[model samples]
Target: MKIAIFGPSRRVGVVVDNDVVDINGAYAKYVADTTDTARSTAAAALEVPADLNSFIEQGAGALAGAKAALAHLSANSITTGLDGERLVFALDSVRLHAPIDGKSRVFAALANFADHMQAAADNTASGSDKATLSRLVSGGPKYFIKDPRVVSADGDDLQFPRRTDLLDYEAEVAVVLGKRGKDIAADDFGSYIYGYTLVNDWSIRDNVSFGPDFQYSKNFDGSATVGPWIVVDEGLDPQDIDVEARVNGEVRQSGNTKSMIHSFAALGEYLSRDSTLFPGDLISGGTPKGTAVDSSIRDSEGGFEDDSAFLNPGDVVEISSRAIGSVTNTVTGTRTGKK
Candidate 1:
């Protein structure tokens, strides 16, 4: 089942078709109106948290509670007086926030896709060695930490950094962890994962050559675009899902998760080696071959003269996947001065 935080109150919601059911509100009312024994049982069965992060931390219990609550609302519709019509809200009536927020560490893998690595390598200056890309292919999955502050929800504007002119968008599948564990095995990744979400790993191409750290380019405010909603991992295979990105309305990036050199499970194992992988922590499984800055589309002078290839102020970027829904954001604001 898909879950989201929507409306003015940012209440927890369960997505049913085109409507969102207020799970938290409904469960609270259910507890308040029921008998003492019933209330206790309901409370135990549905330990629904106020936010998405806490709800995910509850793991299987949360899933079971949500199902039970939905079942309860369906079985005794007249008794509760909170039927589908009253509890469910149309998708357009509410606004979405970053599904996982508040202390969720965002880890992103780099050069995990062969095509992306090749494209990035080909885009570099002539005679430049692609040792890093080669290392990524041969060695274990390499990851970088992204500031959770950069996370923006669907329909929100992606704020352009004042320091750079070469902004780019990367389409990736973000894995959300359900449980905390250290030295987690790759095979046991399914048990640890709570769900999956779409992520636009925005980057500033100009910043890469000027600095050794990627934080300056990748971690700017509103760079990481995530959400629409989270699809729970109920026998879902994230490794073979279709991922794509579009600017305005034109398709730019198109690839599959199956092309990933390091699978999500492998990346999970690598990430959980020394540190604890907690619930709500996000791990983005890198993008495909088609970023705006790809050398394949560059001219002989090594410049992309085409304005449409790169993002400009007021441009809309939509990242979509079959397993997870689409995350659409517009470039509403940009700063021109040097930092």
Candidate 2:
């Protein structure tokens, strides 16, 4: 089942075709219409959390309850109306937020795709160190922590940081953890995963080459654009899904998850070797080979010049996949100053 946080209140909703079933709202209605003793029983049987983060943290029991509630609603003919605005609202009517806002530790893989690594290699100067590239090619997935505050929802505007001229977009697939585990093994990866979501790992290219730290280049406010909704991992295969990205309706990045240098299980094992991965922690699989910086608009010094390839203030970036839906964000004017 696809789950989402919708509307101004950010309530938990289940995406059903072209509409969303208000799972939390339905449970609340059940409690309101039942007797004192029956209300307690109903609440326990249909325990849908108020938000997506809390829902995920509740583990398997919460998911089961939510599915039960959805089944109950469907059986009773309580689905949305013809206009898709009754108990279930039209998918476009309500606002959608990042599935795990302020509730997840965001970690993203760097150059996990062989083609992306080749692109980065081609763009770098001959005098540059190849040690990091060599390590990524042979070693496990290279990752960096991103601030959750940078996460923005679908349809939200991405703020162009004034500090940099080369803003780029990376379309990636994000793994959402359901259970907590330390030193998790590769074979047991499925037991710990909850679902998958779309992630636009926005980057500032200027800050990247100057130093080794990725936080400065990637963690600016509204840098991580995530979610139309999260598709549960029950029947979905993250290893072989199609991933694509478009800027202002023009196709920019086109690739598949099968091209990943490191598998999802390998990334999970590497991440959990010495630390615990809790529910709601997001692990973004690296993007494919078609970023704006990979275009042929580079300057003579191999840096991106102010050109058509780099993201501008009015550009609209839409990142999509076959499993998880699209996450579209428009670029807005930047605030001038260090953020």
Candidate 3:
């Protein structure tokens, strides 16, 4: 029951390859060819599962119904032209967009990992006063909200800002919210999730500090690199997966989700309380240890200063998770005022 949205930009069409069904096409075909009623969201096209947001709008029932329909199709050996074709397009061919576009708000955790915080501390000249994941909860849930414009899909190039020489990568697994819920109970957190994906939170080391507004550092354009795809049916516990960050095929970061201070369910429930969460909202649960920023593999001998080694043009970044798959992107730099 792995579903995907394909096409250019916001005009993506839905596809369920296993069933040879096109949710977008089926909706149109049914409205014109059958007696089925059109749905405001893509959920009504149960014969074909649509986007993750559609799952959010329809809830758990939509998933069950779509599976039943897909089962019926699989048994009959249904074949659509898009079956194997679209899947091939997904592999290194088409540029993947954020699985769900225009998500209202992105909830990001800060210092959610003791090792990550320690790495952050190591990178900067600051003393060890920096909090780690295990000790972060001594206060409240340390979190941040990312500007939606900063979000970009996989296979796209991120522009390295020339103003700052330090560009770092934080590998994390992000959850896609499936349903709208406020004050969600911990027991019912699973029902609110659609699936998971890998996130590479690109950062500007200099801009990030205890300033009046920390959002400026994390919310730059293309700072949010998500997708490759969302696993709609792969019943995975986000906190149980392993995450890795590699640069030019060299593993720079490696850690397991078991080290997360707050579990995925807890973060979701905490954010939803007293606040409304809509379909397509992204919740990134932070990264683990061995991040590139904390490693000593930079080309400091040459003019490539240690800070300049953060991320330069022509560098490739690969972020992967055991369950959500991998997403790789190339980095390119541009002078700020240059036309």
Candidate 4:
């Protein structure tokens, strides 16, 4: 099901497929109303459950109950419609919001590709041991956090900031955690997952290496563009999917999840062991080889030039993975108005 959380900040209403029904608020009320008297953790918390988290937290039984109620409702054709065909939105109608808002921690892996390592090695063959090394060659998934404030929806406009002119797009497959787990094993890892989503790890590569840390280049106002939908299905493997990025109709980057140095299950089990992963936390599986930003084949600029189609105002960036849906976002005017 394609679940959507919409409406103004305070007046926001959770709807399923543009329905007027308040699945979001109803799910919350279910927990608040039934937590004390609810007999089964999975007992029906409300007429319909808004998200997987609510159902899981309420317990397996509550989730089953909610599903049953939804099924019954479907059988009877009793439901509310939120003007599915003609709904008006305050933001750009095409603009997308983070599928799940306020994702507390965004753990991203840097250069988790052997190709990236080779490219980085060639770029610094002088052996000048400067800081800021690519983690793909040195260690496990290099984790980073994306500020929640910067998260945007799949089709929303990515605002370029005034700080830098160098902007690059990373095509990646991101995993959406459905449940909390600690020290989870790779073999038993599927249970903790909710589903998959597409994430474009957009960044400013030039200033990224200049700063004392990557946070500056990586965490701009609108860097993390994620999601069109959250898929909930079984028997799906993350490591065997095709990941690609397209700019304005041309394919800029293309690779497979199989190239990832670390698999999704491995990273999940590894990250969860000491720290708990809650529902809605995003773990980006990392970009693949062929990133124009990191390539040895430099454009005429001597430095990585924007000609590799560094995003300009009105450019469309699309990230797609077979396992998850494709997310197409447009680059609007830079936050600095320099572009």
TM-scores for every candidate against the unseen true structure:
0.88, 0.88, 0.79, 0.76
lDDT of 3 by residue, 97-174 (tens): 676666557788887887866664554443323333225545656788877656777788888876666678889988
lDDT of 4 by residue, 1-339 (tens): 333444443222223443433443333333434467543223323434444445334444443444443444445454432223222233333334566656356788766777655664554433332124443356665567788666777657787666766678888877777777888899987777666677788887663453358677888876888776665553567777788999898887888878888888878877887888887777888886556556644433335433444667788888987666688888876635344
RMSD of each: 3.5, 4.0, 5.4, 5.7
Q: Report clash pairs, candidate 3.
A: 56-178, 113-133, 114-133
Q: For residues 1-339, could you state the per-residue lDDT of candidate 1 as single tens digits?
A: 888988876777888788787776566555655645545434633587657787887777777777876777667762232333356678888898888776889999887889987886776554323554466667778778788865888999877777777788999998899888899999998788888888899988763642367667778888888898889845778788889999889898999989999999999999999988888999999999888876334444445545356778888899998778999998866646321
User: What residue pairs are clashing in model 1?
Assistant: none
Arrange candidates by TM-score, descending: 1, 2, 3, 4
Task: For candidate 1, report its TM-score.
Answer: 0.88
Candidate 4 — worst ten consecutive residues by lDDT sum?
A: 80-89
lDDT score, residue 44, model 1? 38
- Candidate 4 — what's its lDDT? 0.62
Specify the poorest-scoring 10-residue window by lDDT in model 1. 77-86
At residue 191, candidate 2 shows an lDDT of 81
Number of clashing residue pairs in every model? 0, 0, 3, 11
